[model samples]
Target chain A: EAGVVQSPRYKIIEKKQPVAFWCNPISGHNTLYWYLQNLGQGPELLIRYENEEAVDDSQLPKDRFSAERLKGVDSTLKIQPAELGDSAVYLCASSLGLSSDYQETQYFGPGTRLLVL
Target chain B: AQSVTQLDSQVPVFEEAPVELRCNYSSSVSVYLFWYVQYPNQGLQLLLKYLSGSTLVESINGFEAEFNKSQTSFHLRKPSVHISDTAEYFCAVSARGGDDKIIFGKGTRLHILP
Candidate 1:
């Protein structure tokens, strides 16, 4: 009955430091996504996981950003050597995996607010 | 690749007044359209979505949007606005096939006045 859950509601870090955000999706959801939302802008897809497999990550900045969903239930998004521009809210969402019978309606978590100085 | 455009950056209206938020998309393939609302410090919530069947979709909160293939637009409207409805509304589009990665617009901030 609980919705998606995320950890560390807020975080502040200096430039060049490392930061991480965690997320726990709704029960029975097989698809997980990580999105970055900057101020005055809509959320942008960073990565998506179908079960434990990352299907899309082109939008992710490989040099500094990385994500993983080991058990296919909870996910973690990390940014190493964070920059000022990396300050934003990181949102996690999940949905029923796409299949013949499933319709993907992603439910989002509260999100982690990150501030990089 | 798909992209969404929210024509208005912000919409201000009085309570009980009707309002419309415009959204347009560009895609080469078939796609699914969605509208999401985000309250201050909250996550995005689905308002409505258009998958196939009907070109018109309505949300439980009295919000409705019609998908116009000719105009390539999906404009959200509400017959009556409430102060609680004040929030940031996002327009998103996703490919019907492929990875289903959603492309979101800049967002339209709706400010309902009392």
Candidate 2:
């Protein structure tokens, strides 16, 4: 089976500009996650969706960042008025939804590298 | 809340030599541990995971990690490494309950020397 797929492998923008990243999770996966990874740092969770419902988004910066998974299969993460500090990698991952008996592993995408000047 | 710490930011090892990357986690409850590897320009791949088992897990590429609950450590070790092993490795953990949010450590970059 194919792994998670992300679009626009790389993007470059100036401060205050808007940028968006897209992701397509593996087949049959019901959970999707968006993470931000800065240089020399690990990826941090921004938001998580179970099917079409966002189950966790406490870490997301609502002022500038927003995400949606309309069909429960594809997701989009957007950052409006991007700041210089927003330059980093945006990674997407997916896994089977919550289950008490089984915990499926999450698979990741190549990630979109964003550079904001 | 849980957190992970990777002591080494980088590890340089000669080809065919053994290597060990240390990982420590802090959690109040039982959790799941994972080691993911990211090659250049590639996505993160699951190297191994420790849920509830014999405390030892091995990957297909000769890498192994032993979960030590007392020490709160899950260090990855490989008897011998190849050029293909050069990549970034991340250690992460998620609590057994809740939303299963995973916390990751600053990845360790493995460099294979000639």
What CAPRI class is candidate 1? Answer: medium
**What clash pairs does model 1 have?**
none
Residues B1-114 of candidate 1: C-alpha lDDT, one tens digit per residue = 888999899999999999999999998988899999998877889999999999999999999999999899999999999999999999999888656579889999999999
TM-score of chain A as modeled in candidate 1: 0.94
Clashing pairs in 2: none
Q: How many collisions per candidate?
A: 0, 0
Query: Which lDDT tens digits does candidate 1 get at residues A1-117?
Result: 999999999999999999989999999989888999998889998998889988889999999999989988899999998999999988999898855221467899998999998
lDDT per residue (tens digit) for residues A24-117 in model 2? 9999989898999999999999998889989889999999999999988899999998999999999999988766311457799999999999
Q: Write the per-residue lDDT of candidate 2 for residues B35-55, one digit (tens) a residue.
A: 999999789988999988789
TM-score of chain B of each: 0.97, 0.97
Global lDDT of model 2: 0.92
